[model samples]
Target: LTVTMRQRPSFVVVGEVRGAEAFTVFQAMSIGRYVFATFHADDIETFIHRMESKPINIPRNLMLTLDVVIILSNLSSDRGSLRRIKTVSEITGQDQLTSEIVVNNAFTWNSVTDTNPYSGFSYVLKRIAEKEGKFEADLEKEVDIRSKILDKMIEKQITNYKEFYNLVNLFYKDRVRLFETLDMTEEVLM
Candidate 1:
């Protein structure tokens, strides 16, 4: 799998990260390739700790290339058992001590307050702004537009996976058509 991916793959997806192959996954990310893999850990802290220990031992420098780490947990609330994202951590880089990776507090879900589904600034957004040569506020506006698109999808009961993906792609390809189909004004996207 690693050999074929290295040849000329857009991205690589691994079921899980463990053993010797974990290093290869990190290597793939370092060389400007996207690698998505699941790791067994309760949260971001535990996830980072695990990566630095024992058999996996992913390098701190390699860890710097990571974009985001999403922590999902199954919580029991009055509503019922629900699985959701607990926190989202953005990897900024490694600390000067070279002991661990540095992460920015992106967002967290507060079960008690439930004020907003996500709270806090996103480092990934800032990174995206730098990459796209746009101001952070512009990127944030784009995020808002995308959020509105998702909300419209749910409200209109667009539940099928392929359908959702195709719709989003259509929006990217033909903004005016997608906006008209979704009953959203093109100005809203701007």
Candidate 2:
């Protein structure tokens, strides 16, 4: 399966990383391919440790290619059960002396503030900005705008997959049209 996947250029989605296939995922990521995958672990640190140990045994340096780690947790409240992204961390690099991977906290949800504040800086974003010849701050602002577009979609209950996909594409093609279609104001997003 890995051989077949490598033949073509595409995004790879591994349902779970439990065996030697984990090596393939890491290799794909290192080669500038996007991979979406899920693995069970208590937290980000545990996830990295698990991947570096036992059946997976992924090397530390190769792990640096993993740009983002999004942690989703279920929270029980008075209203009902809520599933939210607890944190978004970026793999900065590995410490040469300690041989430990460095993680940068890019975004975290604050219960007190009831908001997710982004640091506007991450290793991956810096690379992307450099490649695109734009400042990291510009890329960060684009991310903020896109996030607001998604929020508007969910708030409006536009749940269908096709509808959501089209909306996002529309946003890229014509930002003004997207705002008009969603009945959203740029001021609110700002």
Candidate 3:
């Protein structure tokens, strides 16, 4: 396996391995390799089921190596709010009794408190900043920028999470256009 890595293939993407391959994949990841894969299940139990009864036969301990799991769900509602729900989860380790996952609270959602469109985003930014070792200013700046953006969003009467999310994505993706369209002052974005 080490010898294979010497070539550094165009890309080494593993396609949802469930058995012994899980051990190999975990070993590779632990050795500082990159993997971008999707799981059939959103939570830990589904993962366990696949491992315990799969052609690949994955070992329980091997699952601990996974660092991230992105959960994507569809609301399937006519009201059409938060249609593309993306929840990013990072695996810390296993629990003692249940022996399931222990998400490190890097960031999370509070259904009760996230009544506002701009909600829990600071926590997400904090986690990213923490990972990048740029926590000193990144988090604060993100919050300040987001707060300003939220003020403008509210002024524009944007309320739904979906619309707010799109606006945020668009603003970041095309900053010049958003600045021109929204007439965002230099003081707010900088």
Candidate 4:
């Protein structure tokens, strides 16, 4: 991780975080580098416990540098097995009195509905809005637009990774042209 950080990359990704390596991951995050790593834990509570305990021992204060945790779960049902995102949680801060990490769950899986539903609040989006000097509503609108584009891609069976990547890049470079090619209108973004 130290060697890679020297390159000053925009973000760092670790396939899996285990043992003392988690310290380096948190250190990278402490320095304002975005870090994406998978840690094996049954749930958010377990994740926090493990990280705070021996082997990992991430300091409570340093934990503030961590932004989000996404949990994926595998479920078996009548329709066979499916892997789905179980939770999307944001680390807001530490409790002032107890010094415990405060997490806000922005999205959670609904097994009954077999869908991930937004919790109607997101500190992460609020932070992004503040950083970008935009209203939270504006960011929400952008999310809606992007969601529509992704849905359109799935509907059209454009599942190839390369194709999806190029199309997403095109959306950033020539949004109007991409919308036209996708038979969509900017009005839909409203």
* Best candidate (score: lDDT): 4
TM-score ranking of the models: 4, 2, 1, 3
Candidate 1 on 1-190: residue-level lDDT in tens?
6786649687988997778888888888888888888888998889988887898998777777789988888888889988877778888776777556777766777777752254447778877789889998887777778878887898899999999999989988997788888898865746
Q: Which ten residues in a row have the lowest lDDT in candidate 2?
A: 1-10
After superposition on all C-alphas, the RMSD of every candidate to the true structure, in Å, is: 2.4, 1.9, 6.9, 1.6
Per-residue lDDT tens digits for candidate 4, residues 69-144, read 9989888999899898999999998898988889999999998997777888899999999999999988887887
lDDT of 3 at 51: 56
Clashing pairs in 1: none
Ranking by lDDT: 4, 2, 1, 3
- Per-residue CA lDDT of candidate 2, range 1-190, in tens? 4875658667887787788888888889888788898887767898899999998999987888899988878888776997777788898888989988889888888877657788766788898998999998888878877878888887999999999889879977988888889887654357
- Separately for all candidates shown, the number of backbone clashes (residues 3 or more apart, or on different chains) is 0, 0, 3, 0
How far residue 60's Cα lies from its native spot in candidate 2, in Å, is 1.3
lDDT of 1 at 16: 79
What's the C-alpha lDDT at position 82 in model 3?
Answer: 57
Candidate 4 at residue 58, lDDT?
A: 91
Which sections of candidate 2 miss by over 4 Å? 188-190
Clashing pairs in 3: 19-56, 19-57, 20-56
lDDT of 3 by residue, 89-143 (tens): 5666788998876764333444455432333334445656888888646676766
